[model samples]
Target: MLSAGFIVAVVFSWIYDITPGGIIRTEPLPKQKLPLINKKVKTYRFTTFVSVIIIIGLLSFNIIDSASARKIEKIDKTIAVLPFTDILPIKYESIVFDYIGNQITAGLSKIDDFNVLPWRSTKNFRKGNKDYVKMGDEMDATILVDWKAIEIEGEKRLTIEMIVAEDEKILWSNDYSIKNSWTEISVISTEISRNIARRLRTFLSLEERARINEIPGSPTALYNAYRGRSIAQNALYLYEMGNRKTDLSDFDVAIDLYTQAIQVDSSFAEAYANRAVTRLWGIYTTHYSGNELEKCLEDIEKAKSIDSNLIEADIAMGFYYYYGKRGFDNALKYFQQALEKDPANVDCLFYLSLVHRRKGNWDEVAELSSQALENDPASALFYINIGTSYDYLHDFEKAIECHNLAIAILPEWPA
Candidate 1:
């Protein structure tokens, strides 16, 4: 029995020795797990994640905003005011019509943002029986101001309507009525001007409105200096319209008109400049050379002596240097100078592009052509220059592309 007990005890000791160490162990170890995260740390982590997200969103928004700004910057806005219609009741009231029309025109002229047609041109518009839409297109007018004055109950009532048309579609229109009063004519004129300006402000900025408001008026001279200036301007317009025979007579008339204007107001810079152009035209179209050219130069110099800031004088000098004398460098210098004075001067830009092309400066030709295009995108001559520039640079495909665009814009050669 004792030997059997000994055997059992020996088996128990072997089982205990072969058992895993943790199962046999009796003492418990101290817990060593990390403490639960505090609310502050969790809040910090969440805030950091949100801040990172916000930063990324802000950066993306800025990038998109900058791209949108660039696109908006490229858009250009232009406006033109059409000729005002004469609204007179009687034949004798034509003089009244002229006075009222002149007043309205003078008021609108104060605003610089708009290209206002001169009263003389507007008056001549009725002579051709031209369609108002076609006239608007020819004059590049975006807005038309139609006005009528009639006797209502033996009292004069002036009705004025403003229309904005593109492709003959009326975009906006408004009517204004005013009673005639000679004593308050200036006040009435100023009111009409302000209303027109306000309507324009819907599309134009304040600065542009101010520009339209600053147009100068005819000086109070017995001879009507502004009227004389208008006659000279019309003569040049005729010359540009290619009526050489008529233009020559008009030039003579312009000379007389400008001389009268200068007599009335010696400080009339425009009269001197236009007279210089008229004199230059005489030398150019009369087949006069040598002494005539010298005479033309003297006349232009006198014009410059009268007003150093005249753009026409610079243009005249440039043309003389380029076409008459073939002095390309001098021509380019004067052309560049004129462009500096008026960046939107199409004549100067066109001449400069031509001179650059002649000088084999293809880059400058392209640059000047681009500037001219900005001023007059409808001009086929500018596109032709662009195409030629590309052709000279061996960019045949681009040359053809530009030529095609030019042809598309102006289908006929003289168009």
Candidate 2:
């Protein structure tokens, strides 16, 4: 209506005169002045058209954005937990500082209704002055969970907040004084997970509640497992960064930590499973010479005997077939099982992509790689996998595009 009225006013001003005398049709200007008047009118019209176009473009963008936001709201159950910020003195910033957030994230991932983004996808936001809502949108997460640890008057304190991604509103928040023992921290993580779930109005099943409440066999074992897992996670990141030849040291350290955990608690299935994974990758990176495949299989069997539904065990078994035996068929089966339990698991998606690549199923390879990339967008390895699939499929244009993206993300990587 505003646009139409503006146009009508412009036309009326050109065609009529509103003077103190009366409303009247304007007579044509003198020939001497007519050119100048016409030029002014033409400029005004061009400006008006441009203004209208700008208005339309702005309106169109808003409409599209609103629609996208609505679509995002429909998936509000999708959540991303960012890494915890440590503001304590440098002396206290150890593996314990990282474990709180990581434990809560693991607990929440057990819930069926909450589609939690993998930690790999959200960890990079730890040090940035990031807008939580924008990060959520980038990761296709409709909610964000963040926490920070700070020391106040010699007392360690932590504050946790859940934010709605659409408006960056704090939907829920709580604070706690940090605990001294690893067991207490584990309990605190479970409490935080439960509190967040309640804030979201979701019902946690009996099994999920058990998972959140289950502390490992002992504080010593749990601490060792936590440290091992942390080291392994970093080692995996370094491996992904194309440091294939020199990254074995971290893996070895991680393996030793896992072994310590296993010694502390013989029934620690997770530690055994993680040790198997580190050993498998260590050998795979060294062209299957660092550790015996049978030792890796023994860990897998030990973990599975203790807990048949262990996802890590399944993953280790999948790699056992892929990297150890080159048994693509068995690799596919184990990976599929793991993916069924955790659809957004980046490792399962990545391994499945590799298996399909070996089977010459380019379409499946691309599909799995794309899913993995969604969970770990900054991962150059996933981009390379997608590029390889495109290359094999004869899509040279897209193949080059994917490789360029990988190179752009990792410019220091060797050609």
Candidate 3:
């Protein structure tokens, strides 16, 4: 006969059901993925790069910069370009500033030398004023770019500054006037990105220079894409700032932002996918009505039909299957497809782990969660999944230890 403790362990294990991926992102896995159930996940995980210096960070998208980011690995190489602020006389011209700010970020992302933090990730740092040097250290950024625009009586003034990451020294500064059309904005932004890259690398390759100069042949399409990206970027900013609230306010605002993007460019497939995912999150987490869920599904289908190769489209379909429709089999397929394209996507990995758990594959759960943890070690949910798997295996000691680690990260109960 089985011992009383063994029976109790099995009973308690079945009673455990904790969900991950709230504010700080997480993925799931089965028990076998974890080498030892009690082993703590490693932090300071780096993005895939050939350089010896690892980027010691996530973006400042989180409401608060984490105190646990002990050291910034490559301060000299990592750069952060904040959204441009407006000191315009006209209030509504602020949208123009948003457009220019996004152009700068998108421009920098194309360069290979620096790890540019996405525009959405810099949203939280837009608070009126702060110490740029301290911000650089907190963000693990070695180069800091700040831009501001002022428009008055028929003249537009633009100022750009680059700060040294170690000490907040302005290495380069320029002030120029925007005397050209809106189309000139992209050209100006690209030149700025190239200037920064050139400063860091000392010389730009032929390809790098070409990429910086490349603009769409049709000026109309170029303008529309930039405008749509700006609006979508704003929605993403709201989403990041929302930081996983239980209410639908954050998701709803993001939906509105994407709606504006679609209005500007009806064929923006990525914007549709973003809306669908945000709506889907609302459907699962908030008290969103069926209409929103239906809209979410519609957006997903529309995005998939529009751009079959979009990774976000695949991720939305996966979320729909797993969380919205409870179709684990289809969810697994879609998520795997998404991960195959964007191998380092932390969200897709965590959601896939959850799907494996539903399929009753504890070993798969361990494997998925473990890999996700390598890229996202601070995720409490990943640790929780590993802990639960050990609990089921009657490794009570390891289980308790894992649970304690999760508690340390987040003191609240995991739902």
**Candidates in order: C-alpha RMSD to true structure:** 20.4, 15.6, 27.0
Error of 1 at 163 (Å): 2.9
Q: Which candidate has the highest lDDT of all?
A: 2
lDDT of 3 by residue, 1-415 (tens): 2234444654555565545743332345577785653323332222222121222122222212232222222345666777665455544555566666667777786676666765544643554666887778766677888887766676776788988867777867877678855445777877787777655544567897787787532333445444544443334333333446434465556567677667756777777877777767666664365467688778888988887888888988898887688889999999999999878677778778788878888788767766765553334555576577667656677667667766655565351
Tell me how candidate 3 scores on lDDT: 0.65
How well does candidate 2 score on lDDT at residue 100? 64
Tens-place lDDT digits, model 2, residues 137-244: 676788888887776566767788888877898878999786565335666777888988877767788999998888765667877788877777666656766776
Tell me the TM-score of model 3.
0.54
Error of 2 at 386 (Å): 3.0
TM-score of predicted structure 1: 0.49
Query: Candidate 1 or 2, higher TM-score?
Result: 2
Q: Which 10-residue window of candidate 3 scores lowest in summed lDDT?
A: 48-57
What lDDT tens digits, residue by residue, belong to model 1 across residues 116-226? 655543543442676556766765666666666665665656666665534454433444444544223334555676776554543445765564444222333212434
- How many steric clashes between backbone atoms does each model show? 10, 0, 13
Off by over 4 Å in 1: 1-77, 83-160, 164-195, 201-250, 293-306, 377-415
